[model samples]
Target: MSLNDIDNVVEAFVKGARVASKSGFDGVQLHAAHGYLIAQFISPKSNERTDGYSSRPENALRLLKRIVSAIRSVVSKDFVVGIKINCADYTDDHDRHALVLDHFRTIAAWGEVDFIEVSGGDYEKPDFLATQTRSPRQALFSHFSRTAMDAIESLKQESTLSAPLPLILLTGGLRTPELLHTALAARHAHLLGIGRTSILCPDLPRLLKEMEKETREVGTASSEAYWSSPFRPEPDLTFSPIIRNLVPTIPLVGAGIGTAWYVVTFRRLAAPPTSKGMSFEPDYNLGPLGAVFWMWIWVDTRPTSGMKVCRRRLSPIGIVTAAFHARWPKSPLCKTLMEYERQILGLKLEAGSLGLKETLAGREVYTHVGWLALVSGAGISASTTYIGIVRSGLPALIHERVTSTPADWNAFLTMVRDININDIREGAAELRAASQRERLMEERIQAMEVQCGIRAAPRDLYY
Candidate 1:
């Protein structure tokens, strides 16, 4: 963003805080997790700016700090201000977890924040929030939260800040009350939060409270007997494997689907119940696929109250185009190419046709084919700025291998690690060429105008 844009954003945050405070909100938590704008600025890979908000560790947090300071200045001291931050990006980098903890220490030491919610991963790594697997990892982010809490304690002991140390709220894959109770008892976090669990069981807190009373009557440990309760209902955050495989192939799609699923579900829950005594219950009838379709329809047909007639007519197209910046994962041509490749190679992998082979050579060959299909057949516009390239068949390979045999699992790992550099470089070149070729057209037009001794004509000039 330009300096002006950054300033505007900070002003907007302060204004929002002011409004919230006046509107009787007790606190406002800055959502800096899950790769949102603040999170993006925090991430080293994403923030490439050089003017104050640069990727330099010290400067990277400039924007967030400015907003926090601005908000603090505007709001009353009694009003609380909290922040939700990622533990790590959940990439291959082992040091990133430690780095994020260090960042959190800086945030905590500022003495401006009231509470801290420790969450990890972004849309690309949605498994941290919720997973498609039958058994999701328990307390996915508790270790990070624990480490952060230790840092906060050390900061409190060394520093002379009068402001109370921030309370840590760890949230992720926390299904059962037992897990919540265990985390609090161990002091891993000051408070606990749930995601998928809350969606499935909105009355989970009440249910657990009543269960706690029952456990005390029997003289049984609440945590120990919590699992045996008949009321425990598994949260179904799973989408079809095919949808999962397809989404990751398209940029930002994995994130969009996760958000859209919740939005659609919440809308369903908010409506007055059709049957008696079904108020506030989850609408189990809406499956993942149904939710996504309904989300699309709802967004497409939403009331365009102050929009112009032309804009209203074109709004649906704009929505799809905005969501899928350049590449269309649902392109028939791309699907046809993948299907054709699968048929010709006599390979049929579940959840979208492509799979990993036991041999390194086969994997390399498949990767090359997958790259061409995605780049050429996806109809990626040349004018679009290239953000990142998708590792063509990896998502499908991983999805298929999820339930595969041990040998296949080992082969999947091998295929991932044993990539031929030449094949990858060639695939990258293909994607690069597609982007450059599109930009080249505009460049040529400017060159022609220069040669003709004329200024480039704006579209409005011709119109």
Candidate 2:
């Protein structure tokens, strides 16, 4: 994990590659894109050390150089050595925009590398690298790739002065045949990297080739003709790229209704006393149906009031609130709310109980939702109890949680619903009471400090 452990990391990779070659694979592409370990070191935002690896751009390239050198030493010269590199860093300081050309130029200089496939974005910028769904802004979606390609093209042109052209592979947002052909014709890109599209239409390349031949000999193919092709096989996969792309556009109520139905049906079938055991048979059949039903209702109802919030705001807080409810179902509603507030918002309601504090601080909200649902028995009957808990404690929770960071107040409200009856039985009253007691103690300490000139000292000071 530490960059200091480079020697061991390199040895392990080299060893793995040797094993793979021995097993008869053609070659290996060192996956350095998408903010992986190598990409992390190359990126300025992630690599902040004062050592040789962080001092300069060339230093950043050290790990990559070492890896290529090691691989070359073991593999045959004829064996392909390719790399998947990010075109640009989507994050602020790590923005690969300015230095991307230089980086490509440096990599191109390395004689050992045979091919370079370009990609973009880091973990922080999920939209650029991991966007699986469609948006109105199709051009913006491929921003990273576009930027990277521009840089690569500049490098390609410059390199021609000294030597032959470099083989550059372009990936991302290449869903259409026209776009691919245009890029190739313009000499901006040499190879097309098909990802999710290939998964959608595996034989797309073959189909496109046929389409190209038909167009050259006769004329442009009509849409009806394309769809009527008897040679086209039925897709074995149910989730097509089009469907996957459309999912994010599904309304919140639709998603919620789908979730609610599954919870209810599965809760009954997978009920603890079932003879069928806790298998997913019931879930599998009913879950998709529930999802479809919800999606349908979402489309029909077309309610815009509560469904417009982004997933990032909802998912994280929803998880934390769910966890709190599950963990402390028998606890006072106030305690559950306080736990959520502290965990997701980092607003400490109680000063003691390091376990609760640490758990709240470290655990993401969405993750806690399952724990809350499971322990609280809020699975199917979440609507009944969730409301009362929120009504009684939400004000304090919001006041505490949102003081420092402003979150979508509406999304926070939407996450809470009625708790299931089962959750009420599993409630943790003792823990809630303990948390309340801790809050009182802290309050008393603060009052004492103000009144009697008494103050708590840091543990480090005592040490």
Residue 187, candidate 1: alpha-carbon lDDT: 83
Cα shift from native, residue 189, model 2 (Å): 1.1
Best by lDDT: 1
Candidate 1, residues 1-463, lDDT tens digits: the string is 7889889899778767866776578989998877899989988767777777876778877888999999998677999999988765633477776677778788888889889998766776654545432223334467768878998888867757777788898776566665666788888899887676666666876888887787777755554756544343543546677767665464355455565667666555544466888657655566667756777565334444433222232223555443333244443322444444433233222112233322232222222233334345344432221211233323343334233323454664564455556655765676677566545444444333323333432433221
Cα error, candidate 1, residue 335 (Å): 49
lDDT of 2: 0.52
lDDT of 2 by residue, 253-322 (tens): 3334434544334333322444544332333344444544542343112222323322232222443444
How far residue 49's Cα lies from its native spot in candidate 2, in Å, is: 1.1
How well does each candidate superpose onto the true structure, as a TM-score? 0.58, 0.45
Question: What lDDT score belongs to each candidate, Candidate 1 first?
Answer: 0.62, 0.52
lDDT, residue 252, model 1: 54
